[model samples]
Target chain A: MLATVDQHDDTSPEIGGIAVDRLRSIIERVERLEEERKALSGDIKDIFAEAKSAGFDVRTIKQILKLRRLEPSAIEEQETLLDIYRRALGM
Target chain B: MLATVDQHDDTSPEIGGIAVDRLRSIIERVERLEEERKALSGDIKDIFAEAKSAGFDVRTIKQILKLRRLEPSAIEEQETLLDIYRRALGM
Candidate 1:
């Protein structure tokens, strides 16, 4: 009954007996976080650009960034699999 | 030369003539953003928990979240492929 609308309240909207306001609040929180994510992505890109300007290889630096996110053992295992795959493909 | 260390400075360390300080700065920036990303993920999970407590299906909500992150056409195409695969598998 917490988020249930008053039946007599004509201005209020309800879906499945739940108030529209509650649903909207839940959706709006996700929307706000999505905007923040976009901004953060742009900020990260700006840092990459700075690294490039400083004579760094942005592509390699990005790869390094991703590799650093993983455990060393995981990277080594992935490398082993990748090498096997390349060899299987006769590369 | 801005981030290049003085060759005469015994305290300075460099890799391929690039200062470790510069490399550390780049790594640290990514580390900071990763922390922020983890915090944001927790916030999103909290919202999902709120929705779940309010009688919403969190698994379906998570699917909706991922679907929202993609283009409508992409989703439709993926759904088509998924349906074909499922049918082929007699599911």
Candidate 2:
């Protein structure tokens, strides 16, 4: 029965139909991930704006985001700098 | 004349006036650097848009920019990836 399904080029058997369903599921998963990514992007933008309004440079915020994603340690270094700056400014 | 001017705490000598002028120049230079930074930021945004239109993720572009700023070699790595992707896509 499996051989017969494989032999048919145009209409394969139901058992072989799993591949198509799997492909559809994969595409749907990718679509959902993309949607989630868009939402996260908006949240990041809001954070940048908030930082900018607080007298922080938005470019630095963007850089910090990138650095945080690529190098977690870099973020810690930046936080240390922020702490020092705040202390110096008595903030 | 210089001693007389320096003796007056309120109105310092012309020789001491150079310090005030130097401080003004430093402030002006910083202002110019800030303006240039703003213009460069807009240019980077445009580059991100171009990358997005080319099917590249803007988030990746932002990361690339950050990495490039922090680690110059990272940009080369990204360019290598771009080259491989382009070749694989036959573009």
Candidate 3:
């Protein structure tokens, strides 16, 4: 017997024998996290504005942040590709 | 004369001697990338839905994604702390 197919709750679907309340709770938790994520993104934009006002190159800072998130080997591979592209472009 | 202070373009502010057009271009590029990121997040959510329909544990998959993004030492440290917490709770 598939619990989800029984469809007792219209709003929340159950999986296995999991209750509708549990599924709704999971959805609510994900929704709350998403709200927090959006707020954090706005905070990040404010920090970028602060950095720009301080004469920092926000674009370069963003690039550095992306590179730092990657492993060293991945960064090396990206640099190699970048160098190749630069040479091909006669830069 | 600070290029940003002169405020030639009301929409886009310049930094140093950089043109307002160039600054606006950078901002537009970031905005475009953010749009793509949102689309990718939607795609990821769809994948999670598929996984759940197939009876897979979405939470464990998310945890695996997070652990894979971290360095080995960071994961180990996290696991160590998790174990300590579990033991404290008599798990």
Candidate 4:
């Protein structure tokens, strides 16, 4: 009776034929990660603020961080594409 | 003894004078997040593969996902800036 009284969950709600508990676990983990990511992003924004105070372009720093994650060949390919696009646009 | 060998941990490795255990916890948590992120990324790539098989442009989908996270005003500002840039370049 106590267990029944305390349990309003799982009447098991399934989503798209997936087991609800498993789907809920995945959703919860993703939500948790999103929260942590938001916090870490605030930390990153603070670092960008520090960089701005030191007279650095935070946007370029952001691009640099993005580029650092790419392979050299990938970066070269992107740059070449950008060059072509710029030339085509008369920029 | 088993206890002695098992207990050899803090012999505490410090970095930059920060408390070693606290630093280790932060590093370990970040490392855990990185690992989970990598795994979740693979899941996202699988979804992208599914999208590609369904004849969707994944890069555009990625951009849409990015845009969805932005405020409407921010999106408008970006569009305006892009239009200005395009006009400036004779695009």
Best by TM-score: 1
Q: Where does the lowest 10-residue lDDT sum fall in candidate 1 chain A?
A: A1-10
Comparing candidate 1 with candidate 2, which one achieves the higher TM-score? 1
Tens-place lDDT digits, model 4, residues A1-91:
0001113456655454434453344444444555566665565556556555544455755565567668999999999999999999999
The DockQ values of the predictions, listed in order, are: 0.19, 0.03, 0.03, 0.03
Residue B2 displacement (Å), model 1: 13
lDDT of each: 0.79, 0.61, 0.63, 0.57
Interface RMSD after interface superposition, model 1: 4.4
Per-model i-RMS = 4.4, 14.4, 8.2, 17.0
DockQ for model 4? 0.03
Model 1 Cα shift for residue B54 (angstroms): 1.8
lDDT of 3 by residue, A1-91 (tens): 1224346566666656655554444455555555555664675587677657755588776886677568999999989999999999999
Q: lDDT by residue for model 4 over B1-91, one digit each (tens)?
A: 0001123456755444434453334334444545565665666556566555544455755576667678999999999999999999999
Error of 3 at B36 (Å): 21
Calculate each model's fnat, 2 decimals: 0.22, 0.00, 0.00, 0.00
Clashes of 3: 0
Model 4 stretches astray by more than 4 angstroms: A1-91, B1-31
Tell me which residue pairs clash in candidate 4.
none
TM-score of 2: 0.29
Better of 2 and 4 by TM-score: 4
Candidate 2: Cα lDDT at B68: 57
